[model samples]
Each structure stands twice: as structure tokens, then as C-alpha cells.
Target chain A: MNKIIFLLTAVIVAAIIFFVPPIKGLGELAKIIFFHVPTAWVAVVAFFSSAFFAAKFLRTKNFSFDELSARAAKLGFVFVLLSTVSGAIFSKLTWGAYWNWDPRQTTIFVLILIYGAYLTLRAAVTDEKVRAKVSAVYSLLSVLTVPFLVFVLPRMYFSLHPSPINSSGVEMDSEVVIVLIAAVIDATLIFVRLMRR
Target chain B: MKLFGSRCDCVLAIVRKDFLLNLRRRATFAAMMMFALTATASLSLSTGGALLDEKFLAAILWVVIFFAAGAGLAGTFDDEAQAGTLPTLKLYGDAQAILFGKMSVAFLSLVALSTFILPIFLILFDVGVEKIFLLLATVLLGLIGLAAAGTLTAALTTSAAVKGGLFPILLFPVTLPIFLPAIRLTEISFTPAQVDSSLLVVILAFDAILILASSILYDYL
Candidate 1:
């Protein structure tokens, strides 16, 4: 919990850096890198955690693991919602629109809906074991599309979002490279802290 | 010979019992059909028939199919729950068989409902026969995926504290990928000259995978 607070504080401090005067407009796009990207990264982490716990629940037929999996899925859904909203806001500022139906936007929206269903499924079923097993199978099945939706499909199709600097097959300017790396590290630290709780 | 005869009789008895119950409660089917017709008609009217455009029409058709399927699958276990017969059914028959049987009936009903709506959609939207066939085929494949996924999730959530809104919420997202390909195929089918073979293959692959997973995991549910 303390670690989570510390990480969250770091996020706030990062936000302050972007929001405070001197660095505002030109840096606002970079601000999105901090919160929006982390939300997506954490959502992915939460999904994997849910899957892991789901598998464990099925293997051992343990209710605790089932509960853990359900909780992780719930968290994942929240992060997915956050990611979508933040990404939309960022898109509006950078691209002059809130909703573009870009491949990234569309695919992530679908993913969010999928995870939303995952939580709803847990809430609907009364029998604990049946819920766990069924949800486990679903979580696994849904994960199969994540790779395609997040990576392959988006790139194969048209998207307004910038391709990741490393993967776009283009050289990155020194400052942009530094900011991107910092953003990733900061997001990872936040995720690690959240997971500890 | 005597043992096999008894087992066969038992399976038939169970199926017959389920069928009779379904037939007697025509309310469920009637309500679903009415819902589909009303929703489709309202959509067709509200759009001033602009929804007749293949792209817009396909989207509306899919939305209707989705909700109709939800309405049908939502009640799949309701009768069992109301009659308190699920435990009895679970004990007397293979749970897998029961689930598959229910799904098969629901899928058929959805197909029938789609049959009614498809013609109306094509007529209202001015879609060609070729596009209609493509839309119908895509809807069928998509329904199979929906029914399979929906049945399992519905069964899981049937006993939950709040089953009403929860079922659709749970079913929709898991079925979104299936929806995309269905939409794509409908669009492609509208323009037969530009049909992508690979997209069709992907939809087929998705349907097979979801069906297999749903079937394998359904018994546990």
C-alpha cells in the first residue's frame, strides 16, 4: 500500500511537471504519455493477473483463487475504461477530435467492452466453481485477440496514433527517446506497486 | 439390448420433456420475435430508410441480431431455475447434452428470427440478393459464436444476484471480435468484386475456435 501511494505520488509529480506553466502547451502531449500509457500498461498487467489466477483456480478448484481472478478482472476493466477515456482526450488535443474511429481507438474500445463482460459474467453467476471455470476459459480465449488487436491489426490498418518509436522503423530524436523511456519506466514502477497490493 | 434401450429412452424422454415445456411457454419465443420485429421496424423508420445503405444497414442488422440473441439466450436457464429443475436435470442427463440442446434450440430460433428480419432489411434498405446471402451467412456464423459464448456466460450468471442487465453486459464484449468480422463480411459481401478471401477464412476460424472453447468449457459451467 505504501509503495502504491509512492508510485501514485510520482505520477502526480509527473503531471505537475507538465501542467505547471513554462512547460504547458508544447508538453501537454507528453503529459498523455504519463497517464494514458500507464493506464493501458496496467490494464494489460491486470488482465494477465486475472488469467493467471483463473488458471490457478481451475487447477486447484480454489475459491480464493477464483475471487482473486474476479478482482483482477474488475481492476482490469477499470483501467481499460480509464485508458480509453484518457486516450480519447489525448486524441482530441493532438488530432482535433475526441473520437476518430482509428484502429487503436476502435480496438481498445472493443477490448474494454470484452473485459467489462468478464466482470459482468462473474457478477451474474451464483455458483462459485462454475463461474471460475467458465470465466477462466473466457479470459484465456479473449487474451488470444489482444495481441492481434493491440499490435498486428492496428498496424496492418490505418491509424492516427503514432507508431511506437522503436517499432516504426524510424529514428527517434534524443529528447523524444528520453521522454518515451522515462514514461515506460514510470508506468512499470506504478504497475509493480499496484500489483503488490 | 435392454440396457441400451433404457438409456436411449431416457435421453429421448429428457428431450421430449424439454421440448414440451418450450412449446407450452410460447410466450418466450413470441416476445423475442415481437421484440426483433418492433426494433427492426423502428430502426428502419427512424433512419428515413438511410439505413438502407449497405454499411449502415449491416450495423443495424447486427445490433438487432445481438439483442435478439441476448433476449433468447437470457431465458435459456430461466425455466429450469423457476421450476427448480436444474439440479434434477444435471443429475439425470449429461450437463453437456443439456447445454448443447438448449443452445441448438436457441440458435435455430435466432436463425428463424433472422430469416424474418433479413428480408425486411433487404427490402427496406434496397440490398441485392448477393449481399443478402452474404449478410445471412455472416449473421448465421456470428449467431453460432454468440449462442455458444452467450449460453456459457448466461449459465454462469443465471444464479447471480442481478441477472437481468448482467447477462447482456457479460455476453457483448466477449462477442465483439466475432461482431467485427461479421460486419466486415457483410460489407465485403455487398461489394462481391472486392471480397477478401482471407477475411472469410478469419471469420470461419474465429467461429470454430469460439464454438470449440464454449463447448469444452460449458460442461463445467
Candidate 2:
């Protein structure tokens, strides 16, 4: 618990130093970096949890693995929602509009719906063993698209979001890279602590 | 010979049983169709003048399609539960066949509902033949994607205590990727550029993946 509280404190400090100060004339738009990027990172982490436990459940046929997958899915849903809402708010500040139906926005919205369905599926079925098996299979199958949505589709088409890799496949900005890596670590530690409990 | 015969018999038996049950419980189908018609009609009446604008009409049509699919797909599992047929069906034959049969029925019901609503849509909205055909294809493909994914998810969630609320929450996120391209395709059907094949491919890949997953995993359920 002490370690967890310390880690939480570290996250708060990171948010204040890196996110609170305005840089590059981004002003309020920069605040979204703390929320949007971390939420997305955590969402991916949640999905990976589902995938890992799904494989375990399938192989061992253990109810515990299934339960873990379900819990991860619920967390994933919250993260997806957070990413969406924060992204939208940022878009409004930067683009002067709340919703542009951009491909990135559209795809994230769809992902949220899919996760919603996954949770619904868990609830709809009554039998414990059966629900676990079915949902595990679903988590594995649905996750196949995660790569395409997160990486391929955004780059293939023109998007408002900055592409991490340029046309020649180079990093867009070193500072952006540094901030994103730190944010991912911070968010993942928080997610682990939450899920562990 | 005996094994094959029993398997065939089981498949036919389950199919027949589902069909007969659906026929007897025609009210669900009727309600779905009526809901689709009413939704389409109300939109047309309210936005009669706006129908002249193809872009607006296309957007509204897709909204209609989504809601219509929702109304039809929502009840795919209700009758099975009420009649106490799910457990028996699970025990009788290949779970894949049952899922396929149910999905087929849902897809057909969606197509039928769309057929009724389409004509009304054409009359109310001055859409062109090329655009209409493209939009129709989009709707068909979108419904297939919906039914395939929605049925499996719905089946999974229906077992929960508060399924009424949980159903959409679980389903909407899973189906969101499919909707983006679908809505985009419908919106751009009138544009000179050919329909986006990549988006269609994405939807098809998703459908195939979900169907395979549902079939292989449904036996566990």
C-alpha cells in the first residue's frame, strides 16, 4: 500500500510538472496530452490483459482466468471512454469543434461499442464456465483489429492527429516521443495497481 | 453412415424447431418490422424537404438502418429464453449450426425490414439509382456485420441480471469500427470516386473473424 501510494504521488507530480506548464503555444490543448494519451495507453494495456487471460482461460479452462479477463474488459471500457472524451475535448480546443467524425475518433467510438458488447455478452450468459469460454474466444478474435485501428488505419489515411512515424517512417518529434513514453509508463503503473486490487 | 445421418438429422431438426418457434412467435418479427417502418416514416415526414439534399438523406438513412437493426437484433435471443429452448438446443447438436441458423434468421429479418423501409425511403428521398444501390449494398454488408457480431455478444450478455442495460454498453464498442466505414461509405456514395474497398474489406474481415470466433466458442456456452 505504501508503494502504491508513492507511485500515485509520483503520477501526480508528473502531471503537474509536464502537463500543467504550457509549451509550444499549445496552452490548454496540452493538458489533453496527460489525459488522452494515458487513457489510450491504459486501454491498450487492458486489452492485452484480456488477450493474455483469454489465452490462459482457453488453455487451462480455469474460471479464474475468465474472471480476470472480464475485469480487464470492464477496465478497458472505462479507459476507452476516457480516451474518447478527452480526445474530443482536446479536439474542440485545438480544432475549434468537439466532433469532426475523424477516422481516429470514429474508430475509437466503434472500439468502445465493441467493448460494451463484450461486457454485455458476459452478463447475458448465466453459466459460469460457458461465459468464460465464449468471452475468451471473443477477446482473442476482436483483438485482431487492435493493430489495424491503432496503427495502420490512422497512418494510411490523412488524419488530424500527429503521426508518430513520418512518411519515411521516422519519429515526428523527439520531445513528443519522450512525453508519450513517460505517460504510457505512468498510466500503466496506475492500471496495474487498480487491477491488482 | 449412421453418424452422418444423425448429424444431418440434428441440424435439420434444430433448424426446423427454430423456424416453427419463430413462426408461432410472429409478434416479435411484426414488432420489429413495424418499428422500422415507423422510424423511417417519421424521419421522412419530419425531414421531407431536407430529403432533397442527398448528404442529409444519406445520414438519416444510415441512422434509420442502425436503429432498425437494433430493434430486430435485440430480440434474437428473447424467444429462446422464454420458451426454454436454449438448453435443449445446446444439447441437441452442433452449436455452430444453431448459431448459424439464428444468425441467418436475424439477417433475413433485417433484410426484410430494410426492404419495406427502402421503398418508403426512395419515395420520400430523391436519391439516384447508383447512389441507392451503393447505399443499399452498404446497408446489407453493415447488417451482416451487425448480426454476426451482435448475436454472439447478445447471447453472452443475456445471461446477466441487468441485461437490458448491459446489452448496448457491451455491443456498441465492439460494433463501432464497422459503423465508421459504413456511415462514410453511405455518405460518399454519390461522390465520383469509387466506393472505398479498404473499408469494405475491414468490415468483411471483422465479420469473418467474429463468425469463426462465435462458432468455435459457442460450444462452450
lDDT of 2 at B131: 67
Scored against the native two-chain complex, candidate 1 gets a DockQ of: 0.47
TM-score of chain A of each: 0.79, 0.83
Candidate 1 residue pairs in clash (backbone atoms < 3 Å): A124-B157, A125-B156, A125-B157
Predicted complex 2: DockQ = 0.46
Model 1 over residues A30-63: C-alpha lDDT tens digits? 4665567777877888888888887787778888
- Write model 2 residue lDDT over A20-97, tens digit each, in one string: 456445674556766688898788779889889988999888888888888888999999999999988888877788
TM-score of each: 0.84, 0.82
Tens digits of per-residue lDDT for model 2, B1-221 = 98767766775776577568778878777877787778877876776556355566666776777666666676677777778978777787767767877777777777887788877876766566466677777888888877877777667655566655665565555665566677677767855557777777777777777677677766655
Against the true structure, whose TM-score is highest? Answer: 1
Model 1 misplaced stretches (Cα beyond 4 Å):
A1-28, A121-141, A151-157, A165-171, B1-17
**Model 1 CA lDDT for position B168:** 77
RMSD of 1: 4.1
lDDT of each: 0.72, 0.72
Q: lDDT tens string, model 1, B49-97? A: 5635666666777888888777777877888888898889877766666
lDDT of 2: 0.72
